[model samples]
Target: MGGDPVTHGGGAWRAKWWTQGEEPGTTGQWGVWESLGACDGGGGDGGDEEPPAGGFVVSEAQFNQFFPNRNPFYTYSGLVAALDSFPAFATTGSETVQRREAAAFLANVSHETGGLVHIVEQNTANYPHYCDTSQPYGCPAGHDQYYGRGPIQLSWNFNYKAAGDSLGIDLLHNPSLVQNDPAVAWRTALWYWNTQSGPGTMTGHAAMVNGVGFGESIRSINGAIECDGGNPAQVQSRVDKYRNFTGQLGVDPGGNLYC
Candidate 1:
């Protein structure tokens, strides 16, 4: 209730400015996940485990730094959804767990979006720039809503529509709902976090540290096998952010449990 626990790990992704098209990567990169369709048994299965009873603490300045200029759209529900869907990732009751999972999740996001909040490429609004106009809703203009809206940045018209349908909101008509309704945005994020495809049945977090190719894992989720946004260098940058934020908080920043 104080400051969201999820952001506890988001810092890692903010370490470096994830500039797209950059190369050579950074040092000690966390790297994107490349799922061989097998659970490596690194992070234990967390279906039966309970969430960390004690939550992590954060100062106002610190919280704002991580979520800078952001509004509280989903709040507690987003946290709950994140934990409920991926129980295994909620183990951070202690510093170790928090640090590991946080690192994994942030790293994954960085890889997917080139470390920057992406613009809606293939949607009704911003279609033609990134899509073929001949197709239905293939070419719209402008970086419309649903352009990487959620934590994982759900994109594309079908994805936005499907996420809206699951959450009982029509993002297609009012794509701004992702930004306007906090709950809607958070639900979309949780949806992406829970889905498992390209690299077998694993959360996006697992997909990253597990060595699933960053772009490939995201493409699976986006239903765009050709989507090359999930570059590995970006994933490493996010991991860098996670490490820095953890150090600033003086906590493990690994799993669900507080340090």
Candidate 2:
């Protein structure tokens, strides 16, 4: 998964906090929340403007080539739309760094979702385990509703609450939005990528932008279970994808490839 299974702390809640009257980043007025129709390359509220590839290191054609069998729900337009919510993601540092970060993020995402084949977690039997009633907020969305969804396969009630609070979506109460909304799904994945560090010492964005390398990004995602020989096969899987993606982007996959 793009994020660790454990609950995060106050940093994510405070990073994007806004006053009551201020608009959240993902709203239609903010231009980050595009309609699914637009994401699907059809007409929608996003207008006739084609999905832009200028700012992002990965172009639409490159993205399609990277995940040729990706699910229709994980739209390239949706990912481009979500970029507005985190301007620094994959855009930080030099061109090589930017491309490396993009490759790293997509590599982990591809692993988590099985080349973008699965939307929600396939293990339905583990659904109910995601809810932790200890949190005072409780699971307003039913115990099983928060089971892993989106590109990162975001699971758990507190995670939903934190991600929703940061992105201005009520994911805790409407966890299905991750699966139902394409833009929201990509935003959540970017949210975890740019903000939360998971079990590592730094965010995935930091690892790439700061020259810490791709292995650190893996550590930030599922290190507790996969890093330091915990699961070398999984680590290698992520590293192989990172290398493949970086190669596809015509960039070098820097050192420290395995966590």
Candidate 3:
């Protein structure tokens, strides 16, 4: 529901890409991934940390429950790629804060991908609109190829380039990797969570780490259409899921559950 549904206008306007003959300016959020470096790096053994109270935020069995009839191809092992995601999602915080960040991340991702049942965009119409010919790379995978993919449904040419650059994958050329490789899909979600602040809002990670509460996160992910005087139902969906997941994790869902 972010840049994914680009025709929604809000996301394209929020996206930093320049239209043909249009002047470009800094979005402030640009270059945030300069150091993220191709999304590669360390990955520890899954389930390394001892479970916090109330067990883990998301266990394989519970995840299966969340995604009834989820694609069997995307196994729990794929979700395990997120074993190292907390550090990036939380960007180095306390253990409790990390737990909160993880819950918030998974909750929002669930909403984005429909509890992980959808590996790619359901509304395929928006696929072609993601291309920006004006970009230097020019939507390498072709127009319509950048439709929402991965856990967070990352969309837009610049976004794919950024995520690819950060994750060390060539998303610009091979956008299918998000759907093809489940671990890559989850990592791309984390890449977005840890990096993108979304139009006019703080990064979801910042929203959680700064104690700004869950509403800020909603604002961060889809605020343009779902914040303040925007759609309340959509906002409530995210809040309800966050509350549910937090409750399951034994952590308070924090205040300001709506944008």
Candidate 4:
């Protein structure tokens, strides 16, 4: 996994709120709501391009095109699907909210997935060998390492089985499918993000990354909370980055994360 794209780019640094002074508003309440404005441009038919019924919309190809060399494995279409579907987790009417959430969510996803192009194939070495190292399931007698797969990188036989059941894909028996199919992998990621819970809302994954403990804080989501390779110093590093970003805006700088 040394050369793995997801772990390479962005390394493991995000921004945090300032600890020395007054912090910003709440983490997952008003600010996010304000960002999610009304759907209608004053009021209209909702439009054709409007995301299908409960779905949202985004240009996955365009997102990928933005980082061509970084991500070249996952399909542009699959990225788009994940982006679009991810919003439904927030709410049906909150298209704006969904979009805002999606923006924040993608930041973390990009960091974790090494962009959207190569995530599926990046770390999907462990498959079909669900049993413990000592047991080895029904694997080919000598096989042992059964790591994980996809963007959020679904792992563990239990999780794979759960993801497959919810998404109707059968990942336990066919773990490799996550790497083989971008849509399957993307859906699994979306499912995890939408369903998981924690200190701060998982709605803004990047925000959580910058604000909380990775495993203890983010493990509610389906993926392992190992922070890729980030530690507390690295977490603070990300906080510094986001703080710098917020600093340019002249808004109130937030406080240090408790975690």
Candidate 5:
């Protein structure tokens, strides 16, 4: 907490950096998480099981180099689970592909969590508005307080439920877990990364794994407002971090860096 943020796995996406918090405007402090869980010791050459050989595109030192005062919410185990959950991240045959995927993914996460400076959303006014009463799940956490959490700052009861269901947790009922448990918090981000086609595009996982490029990833995470003609600064900000991360990892930032 004192030294540079606890960047356990390594590092990205859609929110803005306007307030030093919130991508799409969400931010908060990183919190303590539950104990670490089972993790594979030996990394593999295949993309199905391994966790990107060197774990992430950059080492802990390199990550700190980019986000100097980043938060410590993202845990190593949390990142590993992301790889395991979506083996395609490391299953590709090319190391460039692996590095690009890892780098691109984390780059996007940095934007969402505000370089890890924010955990829960910063705009308190919109907390209660996240609840979509139309959703059958409703807002179990309360009418308000779902203004994003975790690396991706996942918001809404439906999203919490979806992420929780995939990870075998009850995020809808215990949304706090995303802020309390590091693994759970990261899992939510990964779930969205590997699954949801945010805003109405392909999943970030698909964009990188299929070589669709980092720009597509932005389209996936917050394309609705940040992509296309929504905001150029946000897109470039994400690209800058991605370029920095890939460089630190000794990889190219790839083309199509914007949505």
Candidate 6:
């Protein structure tokens, strides 16, 4: 296939060529390129290009296999698009570590959204409780708008504000974006995975990268409500999914499978 045109130092033009049928922008250092220094007078026509899949360890086919009954709204492309926001997600540590991290993440996501079937929280009764008026910013999007949404079920007015601030999306005021835009929804989940520790001692990303096991990742996400016999069934559900996903990825689920 033809390459994508890229401009480098001193106006030097280059065509990014792929070998072995690899997708563009997905190969990282594995890509081959021909450096066509300096543009002359001739114009080169470039074909329409598809967005990069971010070269994640998990492919679209694998993701589909993981969530066959997923809601159409939770698209694979959206998840790929959101990967740029968190480069270190599944790219850290060894190949096994990388696959494990991806599996762990998707496992948690599957549990949270019920195999990616639900886009937003099902219960409407808890909507008003997500709004904490005591916060200085309060709930600009109204008290009931902050109900759980996206892969991680991000909720609460304060969480919306913090996620918005971190992602530069103003989710505090436009909380619906989490449910409306698939990329935004996935980004919120990634934001929580890579940044927030929740009730745990470390972020989910840290837990996997540091070899702290998948259980710690669950702890980081919802230990306050699920860990230490708080809800063994819930914790086991996540662990079961993690093991299944890791098996699909041909990797061990690793130690500390429970929080």
Top lDDT prediction, candidate number: 6
Best by TM-score: 6
In the range 153-203, model 6's lDDT, one tens digit per residue, is 999999999999999999999999999999999999999999999999999
Q: How many clashing residue pairs are found in candidate 2? A: 0
TM-score winner between 1 and 3, please give it: 3
Off by over 4 Å in 4: 1-57, 60-62, 82-87, 90-96, 120-146, 198-230, 233-259
Cα lDDT tens digits for candidate 5, 26-61: 122222221111122212311112122334443344
Q: Compared with the true structure, what per-residue lDDT tens digits does model 1 show for residues 1-259?
A: 1211112222222223343432211222442211111111113322112222333222233433444334354344444544544455524344544444444454444444444244222245453233223446532333343355655666656666666676677766667666555556556665666554533355554544444423333434442433344454443455466665555444543332110
**Stretches of model 6 off by over 4 angstroms after superposition:** 1-54
- Could you give candidate 3's per-residue lDDT for residues 1-259 as a string of tens digits? 2122121100112233433432111222342111111111112322122222232345454455455666765677776665565455543465456557877887888888777678889998778888888888897677889999877898999988998898788999999888898888887887888788887467888888888888887777788988887888887888788877665444677777777
Summarize candidate 4's per-residue lDDT along 1-259 as a digit string, tens digits.
Answer: 1211111011111113222331222222322111111122212221112122333323222233234555445665675565555545434333333333444344345545655545543433454454454433433322332345676666565666667787777666677777778888778777766655533454334434344323322334322333444355544443343333222222223343223
How big is the positional error of residue 98 in model 5, measured in Å on the Cα after superposition? Answer: 1.0
Clashing pairs in 2: none
* Stretch of 10 with least lDDT, candidate 6: 41-50
User: TM-score per candidate, in order?
Assistant: 0.47, 0.80, 0.74, 0.52, 0.75, 0.81
Candidate 1 TM-score, true structure as reference: 0.47
Model 6 misses residue 221 by how many Å?
1.3
RMSD of each: 15.5, 13.8, 17.9, 14.0, 14.2, 10.1
lDDT of each: 0.43, 0.80, 0.67, 0.43, 0.68, 0.82
Query: Model 2, 26-132: lDDT tens per residue?
Result: 23333422212222232333323322334676756668767989999999889989999999998788778988999999999999999998999999999999999
Against the true structure, candidate 2 has what lDDT? Answer: 0.80
The superposed Cα distance between candidate 4 and the true structure at residue 103, in angstroms, equals 2.1
Considering TM-score, which of the candidate structures 2 and 5 is the better prediction for this target? 2
Ranking by TM-score: 6, 2, 5, 3, 4, 1
The Cα error of candidate 5 at residue 119, in Å, is: 0.9
User: Which is better, 4 or 6, measured by lDDT?
Assistant: 6
Model 4, residue 141: C-alpha shift (Å): 12
